[model samples]
Target: MMIEDVKLSIRHRAQRNYERQFDERNRVQTDGIVTLGRLTIESPNKNMGSEYVPSPGRLIEHAFAHLPPDLREYTFIDVGSGKGRILLHAALHDFKQIIGVEFAAELHAISKQNIAAFSAANKHHPPISGVLGDAIDFIIPDGKCVFFFYNPFGRPVMERVLENIAASYRQEPRKIYFMFLSLKHERGNDADANRELLERQAYLRPLKSWNANRGAWIKLQFGSHKLTMYETADAGNPIKRRQRGANGAAASHLE
Candidate 1:
């Protein structure tokens, strides 16, 4: 393995060790995190981008803070939800329903097992399920919902997924939120490209965005570890894209 891969291995091992120790007492297995190769999953194509990386518990909390109280009434869906970390967290907060869509059979099985164990341990969690298939094929159910994407797939897959969300909105016409956490967001790339894509979509509207460099540029912060959350016009109001931020330092074009 390359040096970078080696460092990632060390950190991953440390995280697993800590989770194993803690999950033993908690009696829930949700600490394992690993990035797999394309061959690992029985996927339909190679457009599935990104590796298995869990959003830190803190980042999830920070995101929830920005969401509305109506969150309790919406179904939470995590696309490319490997290991179902976000689903597990959403369950604790009691979303009406929690779903994770993972194509990898092995990872899907692990998520199912984790959800069962977690529900057994915490009876207060809401209904949780796992969809074992390609994310591109997922049809957003009719209802108030929140979709989460951790840079799960490449641009092509993301565009398709967004189309599904927009279709669901037109069919149901309810409040929706797309919380996207793009790692290492730069000036121009898929991160910006996806944001631009969302902005251009007539059905979907851009509300607001928050990322690592939201304010003043912080020193020594690694870009890969950063998070960006996009909030858009809820429900329908004919708003497609928000204002184009010209003076901003980061890539989140939510304003």
Candidate 2:
């Protein structure tokens, strides 16, 4: 077998092992990928949506590790949250609240059940719940929030979602962090397109520092893919496209 293929095989095996343990330890059913054809929800942008794949637990933790030291003031939201795996993982943190937005009725139901199971297991975790509706229709709560995405939908839908967030910011300016993990998919190019669209947002900028390493650039690995982080920029100092920055580049490498 080719070297990359072999490496991929090993990664898949490792992911399976981790997930099996995760499900057992948490006593929740949050594994497996449900293809688009299998999803039962209907929406105008249904064709723009990607299949349901739970974000890896390790990846989720790595992304959260880079957030501010104290998360008590922030709310954690997983857009297009499938089966609430990420939501369950978010509960381990100190966020004020945890929310999973899902459009699929079948997957949404499963996510609610998973939340119930997780709440039963851990009594002191943050308040976590599932919201069943189209992502664009889900109102952004007026508070400091860390919105997360795992290649949920196409660029068009993502643009709409970003606009919604931007609108919310306009009304009530607050701290907002966007955490996006680009998954390696077997079909379609939504991941790449979504990442590019995120970079193009003028009101958003890539988060440069991570963990305790000041000024250090980091992209936590998920096999060959990486999780990119962005935060709201001062609306007055919007980043223009292809504008040379401090490093004398059109944009930061992360952007």
Candidate 3:
């Protein structure tokens, strides 16, 4: 066989072995995605964010390691959860609740199946549930939340989702940590929309932008999908007060 063929075979074997270890049985490839027009929750016309890819287990582990120990109580939510791959790995930890939201009904069903299988094997984990709907309309849980997004949707949907999340904070006044993966950021895309929305909103603070190149987890040569973390500002934090005051000033100046 040719050297190139040997390399391709090795790559396939590595990917399959990775899946075998990380519960990637539920169609991790992007072959069956509908790309023509808007499909149910995904916007193929306006934003065009539809492709199925599982989050790397090593990246997730590194990200979670940065979070505070108390955040283990926060409900873990994967926005645009494809097949519950992240949920299965998250269950390996001790989160309070685990949830996956997928727009496609078929994907949602598969997520349910994955969760069921994972739960059956690891019976000591927390509660896990998968929701089927557009993430824009999905209600945020009424407490601290750990939201994960892997370039799920385009700008329009991301803006709406952030609006919903911000509104939840407005009503309940609690902490929210956003862990965004693969943030190259372009206008009208998921990463850009999320960054713009968060910047425009006054309640949250962008905390860290980790260097994915320096990352030791997963393959050394993964994509440049940097994991950025953001959290809601606490009432007493100086930055929060200043942000609120600046927002008030901006509103007053507009009048």
Candidate 4:
């Protein structure tokens, strides 16, 4: 196997082992809350299942490590955002807007309640909103957007979302940052294909990879997961095409 493939294999194995350990715990901490900057919100709980665990806090920190230092001007959007943990954290930054899209009705309610409560406490800040809708169907706002995911769904849904984003890029190109966490080895091929497709459109660029050591103690502390950031290239200018005339010449402008 190639060197990159070998590294991915090791990473996948470590992640699986860590997930298994979390499963064995059998404890659900859904109602637990964490403070992000001045906002209080519900945090990730293992009971939500392995798929719902929020991206590791360390992973989020590392992903933003190389940011331009003017994060406040950006907007962060988290799909399948559970309990608003990621959204709340993003709000603490300089992000102009923070939005979370959650399909589960119960989870969506929880997120709204948490955001409302946080807003009441921090009256000086603008309130963040959580929409109850399928991530696949949610409408992404037009602008420089930071999209976040923590293995929210399976490959098929992911593919559809990528296609949707590609379409959006075509319409109104914007810098898009995709942050994927706890990605597995088996999904590497599909992931790379999606990345290639985005690159082919001249829409994205791989920015950084945050790999965490997965020793026994480390796994016990944060579960099994790593994070990576993919940045966006400048949006291409819209191209305008003209139709050919009857004789293959440029079409005359109609009055």
Candidate 5:
């Protein structure tokens, strides 16, 4: 065989091996452990087992790659943080504060353990907090923030989360950036159900969708997949009105 052909064969074999191990590790395990960064979660769906893989760590790293340098001063929050990988990485990036909210008790405990292990390994690093609570009820910090999601749940739950965010913005308007990954599904259409919920929320604008390279790697293992990033505009001053004239009398007098 030609030298190039031989090299290609080796690459193909290596790729296949990687997929086989991923499948074996993920297949039939009840705590959905999707590997994103160093974190993994037990898939909430018991039937699927906890093998539901979250976004790969590389993809998330890419998502934050374009963030302005100033975002280093903001807090980064990850909802449905399975094992706190995102939070930990955010800390390394120098985000002022990093918070991860997870609903599963077992996963939350695991996350804490992982954080401790990481902290001990990197003694000089800042701390990243992993909260044992539902993302819906967790208090959002007041400041420029980055919210990340990896299709943590169904559409209904996403709607409620968006509503909560809207309410938070209303209370204290600030800049918010949303990083959504793995948005497409096997059905091959934009996940409009959740997208619609985001569209209706005030003070949010769909900046644009950029094709993420991480999807290519995922596709190599899981057939085909795509990832998109959508950013939300900074919340501006709340709409208010000035009393320009006498209430009821002014209208009649002008007429």
Candidate 6:
């Protein structure tokens, strides 16, 4: 086997081993991958979705730590939540609500079962539920929210989802946070495309300490994935306000 393929195989094996223990500790069965062909649900946008790969707990904790200090004010929504691994983790927080949106019928059912198992063992968590539907058709909920994405779908679906978010913000201006994590070196990865798409949004502001020399965040690595965070600029933040104003017609559309 090629050296790169060998390395990848090693990583995948290690990850599965770790997740088996992770599932045991959390009393849930959330390990393994289900390719697009294996997904049993029939959805118009199913092809846009990538395979179901559960997020690692360590990387999740690293990413969540950088979110707004008071998670109580924001609802955690995991788009393409796979088997609800992230939802269970979010339930440990004090968020107003915890939700996972997965379109695949098989994965969605598994996620619901996992959530039930998690809740039974840990009864003090916030409201947690799974919504099975195409993310493109899912309406952005009212109030502040922290949207988490792990390269759930292709660029087209992601673009529509972002547009919906912007439109929702226009109808009712509110704070929103976005966390996107994806493989760092994988070719044709949607995470990279989605991150660039998000960067192009005039109204969204990236949250990270910049390294001007490198022209990127000082650190964005979480295991094998790269994580990028953003938040809707506060109306009063003069810098971002000015940025939004400078976008001309595009900025006007957001209003």
Candidate 4's TM-score: 0.63
lDDT value, residue 174 of candidate 6? 76
Instruction: List where candidate 1 sits over 4 angstroms from the true fold.
Output: 1-26, 38-40, 185-189, 202-224, 238-255
Q: How many residue pairs clash in model 1?
A: 1
Top candidate, metric TM-score: 2
lDDT of 3 by residue, 166-254 (tens): 66776677777888776343345556656666666566667654433344433332433456777777733322322336445643121
- Per-residue C-alpha lDDT of model 4 across residues 73-117, encoded as one tens digit per residue: 567888878777677656556777888987666677777876766
Q: lDDT tens digits, residues 43-128, model 2?
A: 88878888887877876676788888899989999999989999988899999999889988999999999888888888899999
- Alpha-carbon local distance difference test for all models: 0.68, 0.80, 0.67, 0.60, 0.60, 0.78
Instruction: Answer with 2 or 6, whichever has the higher lDDT.
Output: 2
Misplaced by over 4 Å in model 3 are 1-16, 24-47, 183-189, 209-219, 235-255
Q: Report the number of the highest-lDDT candidate.
A: 2
lDDT measured at residue 194 in model 4 versus the true structure, 0 to 100:
44
TM-score of 3: 0.74
When summed lDDT is taken over every stretch of 10 residues in candidate 4, the lowest stretch is 41-50
Clashes of 5: 14
RMSD of each predicted structure: 6.7, 5.2, 5.6, 10.8, 9.8, 4.7
Candidate 6 residue lDDT tens string, 1-255: 997676667666766777787789779998778897877766878777889888876567656777767888788999999899989888888899998888999899999999988988887999998998888888788888999998898899999999898878777677888888787786865777888988887778787631112222223223366777888888433222223455454443323
Summarize candidate 5's per-residue lDDT along 127-191 as a digit string, tens digits: 58988766667787888788987666567667767778767777877778777655344343234
Per-prediction TM-score to the true structure, in the order listed: 0.74, 0.84, 0.74, 0.63, 0.66, 0.82
At residue 8, candidate 3 shows an lDDT of 53
Name every residue pair that clashes in candidate 6.
none
TM-score, candidate 2, is: 0.84
Clashes of each: 1, 0, 1, 2, 14, 0
Q: Runs in model 4 with CA error above 4 Å?
A: 1-51, 183-202, 209-223, 237-255
